[model samples]
Target: MSTSGGRPRRSRSTAVRRRPADRRQQILDAAARAFSEGGYHAVRLDQIADDAGISAAALYRHFPNKYALFCETTSGLAERLAVAIAGVESDQPDPRTELSELLATIATTAIDNRRTGGLYRWESQYLDRSDAEPVRSVVITQHRRMRTQLIRIRPELSRADADLITSAMTSVVASPATHRASLPIRDAQTLLRDVAAGLVDVELPVPRLEPPAPAGLAPSAKREIILAESISLFAARGFHDVTIEEIGAASGVPASGVYRHFSGKAAILEAAFWRASDRTTACITDALAVSSTPREAIVELVRRYVEVWCGNRDLIMVYASEIGHLEPDRRTALRRQQRINVEEWTTWVVRSRPELGAARARYLVHAALAAISDLVRLDRSSEPARIGPLAQRILLGA
Candidate 1:
């Protein structure tokens, strides 16, 4: 029988044909899925080849190298994002209407590409600066356009205020990338749009955390630089993907000199983990000291948490993403440290909101932390300081 479109149905035994372009697209789609789930360092070329139903040598014929393939895939994804945002219904004169439309459109795109698209949050670091530039440009363009629209809609907003609000709005739609929370696409889109609206509708205060002074505890300046540079490299390239030579070059040390500060790469990683964990504990302690009540303490905790994270986004992201790659013993210790940090917040939240059982209070604390984590790969707007208070309010449910 012919279908409604008047095309006759093919026999069940008939074989479908794919054009060269279709084959190429199939490879890209397969590669994107493989890369996103396994990460750049963890995913092998043979794995991608298998996923594409091709031999490893055949895969090389399609793309020169893994780096080239990754760049192309990410650049294409960014282009899709640009197209989606630009297509948002813009005929409405009200800036708020446009904002809402934009957020919905972004949410739909994110949900549709959730399987492969969200992988960029973890994998984009593998792309070199030269390869990443085009993707960066496209994202910058979208952010600029969105921020301008936000300022027009709310004329009272300073450029910085507009940026903070825009980042928060973007964070809401981008939240899906950081977690595996599943919902119907329509429900997810609606939920994100409402959250974005709330973030945009509020006024955010400037962040108050002063820049941290260089710690006196480092063994030497060279060691500090090595640790600092290693964190940046690890954050950008994934722990397993980065080499000691690369870290040395970045840190202005020879490969042999790296051994002087730390016995091995894992040692550097362990030190970095402890450093981040210590900083987090210190921030929580200092914040609690200044707040008079449990409720205020929770608020301070949220604000300071955001402040600490924003300042150390690269170190923190790398630490969280690569902690699993560490030796089992070290990984377990760091995880316990992470639990302590969580408990600190959970306890304060329970004390402040007595009606919430420990279980529910812990959930809220995680939800708030999840919101802050959304800012990881997102570019900052002109007023990044406003994100601190906005995140704090989100944490406190204010």
Candidate 2:
């Protein structure tokens, strides 16, 4: 603190200086973690700022609102995945080689960004059309490429079969997003790569021919349309965020018209929830009725489950995400139905794999469900023909 000629020395703060661009990048990274962990509607800007060790004002200086922040988060994720996939050389003469390389890359990317990479599972539906289109294009293009490679690797597999195989493979690689499990990056990459390769190499039996479309009368067209559109809107925006007026408009009806089919907004959600639950139960019941043995029953159950999932992804997605918003009676009813489905699967699993015991069988059944749900979670569902048999194979431990 002494200076020459008795001049006083000025004290300076010791904080390290970061460029604005570096700070902005830090904010984006923090936002990604927050959005992935808590979802778009649940997370607050100030919370993100706190996580980033910055002020809310500083956060806004970089991104105007939560919507913009989410758009950036999703766009960044899509860009990274696109770049990683693009680096994969798909023209290799050996199709499995190409698949192995792609799986390694995807697994590594997923592990490295484990906290954020899986946000699309629950958050992507909330994206606006303008933002969703680019992300969707990136994801779908990658899917198509994988499906093409799969078919090339196994020419005997039908296109639908290829789609399912590719979806299952991708789901295995992206499994970390939904769970809190941790693994060393190298370990995760190796395990996921092996699983994806194994999934790709399996030769599943041909699916039983699907029964004819039922001849029963359909639900009222207007009511069905209203429910369908409402589900879409609810999926894209959290249930609480969407208005009945908006749902009505999306369904091509007046706001008052929505009242005719359902009592109110919550009622629409209840109907959607019940419909998804009821249909899922029916699919399982019908599958069981036709299978002669426990093993056959399990396979048929998974096949029908995947069939239901692909045909009703939006509704199922909405149901999974918004069931908490339903009234207590409807929520309990739906959950009860869901438990029954799980119990049915558990019973069949125990009968088929006696060594697994009831507890292990139950866990595996949930795991199998997770495998199928994560595919939907990651937005990778393709043709039902493909997803169904693949899920059946996974569930049967083929």
Candidate 3:
């Protein structure tokens, strides 16, 4: 019998064909749960199969390897999430509000898809060289898309600021699952809203929770101690999603004592960021001082920077975000340092690709710095092999 759509209403055979697709979903769901609750290293295929209410052998028929299945599952989830975020419905007239809806979509979608969220939490690392590069391309496209939309809403935004905010917003939304009992979704939404608003020259008054107790860290160790804690949290949670108290607690310092050393949470963030950025700049700067070829110097600098930071990327997250939150004087100082560093970067680029002028060189440097900055907190520190390839792409653009 023909159905209204001009197809057979149901055949036992056709019905059976649909079942595998559904079962694939079930396996993905279980895998997400297993991966999210515990990361990739800990996930067990047998247990995942059990969670899916299937035998391991059956599951293997659908997904031969755990990593392969995970990448397939999470790739879909990320795409769906990216689409949901891209299609946010809002009419705020303000760029920030629009961006807020978009980010809120990401956070809420993740929250709703607790299993997938867990998968993201657990299996983000499994997206290795092959898996990650395509996703990065998609992300970059989305970034450019959103930035174009933002500029339409607020034309005053500097390309640098737009790029920075876009990067930070992405980090915040994709940050780990929060145990924030009272205000997880709301808080996440608000952070995005405020960031977007700030982009459009609007002032968003958000609450700042009370600062934690000051820690008795020696001057030299204070920064390291904070970096130690912040690296993991930022690496796991991203910058906007993590709080000062969490950093303090993770660092094994009494929350209150941390404030005694810095002015405020943002300022603490500011200090921590500069520490790492300066170190990186120093390494690069020092390399530039002696190396003959600008290209060689740049490569070595990026190589050293990548090696050190990828090993401890959580610190880089703090560096990436914290600098932006500083006071004008502090921000100026930090920017000045970065500017001097960029001059070297610009020189290298101009020499290698003569068509790319100083302005383009600066943007290239910024983008590369932005990408490399993320490596600090990578869970698999052994991903050193990945960094040189990334460095080449970012700085050289071939």
Give the number of the best model, judged by lDDT: 2
Higher-lDDT candidate among 1 and 2?
Answer: 2
- As a whole number from 0 to 100, the lDDT of residue 273 in candidate 3 is 63
Candidate of highest TM-score = 1
State the lDDT of candidate 2 residue by residue for 1-398, as single tens digits: 65897876666675465656688888889989877765666568898899888999988888889999988888999899999999998689887788888888887787778889756664456788887988988878787877877888778987656766787787777666654444556766776676567777676656557663564664669999898888888777678789989988988899999998899988887887777778878977898899999988987888788777766777766655565465557667766777778778878888887875665455445545666775664454244554555555545555
**Over 4 Å off, model 1:** 1-26, 37-42, 51-54, 122-134, 206-229, 232-263, 274-298, 310-314, 317-385, 396-398
Which parts of model 3 have CA positions greater than 4 angstroms off?
Answer: 1-21, 86-97, 118-125, 152-158, 180-398
- How close is every model to the real structure, measured as TM-score? 0.69, 0.66, 0.43
Pick out the ten consecutive residues of candidate 3 with the lowest summed lDDT.
199-208
Q: Mind giving the per-residue lDDT tens digits that candidate 1 earns over 134-186?
A: 88887777677678778877788877667767766776676665445446678
lDDT of 1: 0.71
Give the whole-model CA lDDT for all candidates, comma-separated.
0.71, 0.74, 0.60
Clash number for every model? 0, 1, 18
Model 3 lDDT per residue over 310-368, tens place = 55556654444333345557757866777787777778878877876665555556545
Root-mean-square deviation (CA) per prediction: 7.2, 6.3, 20.0
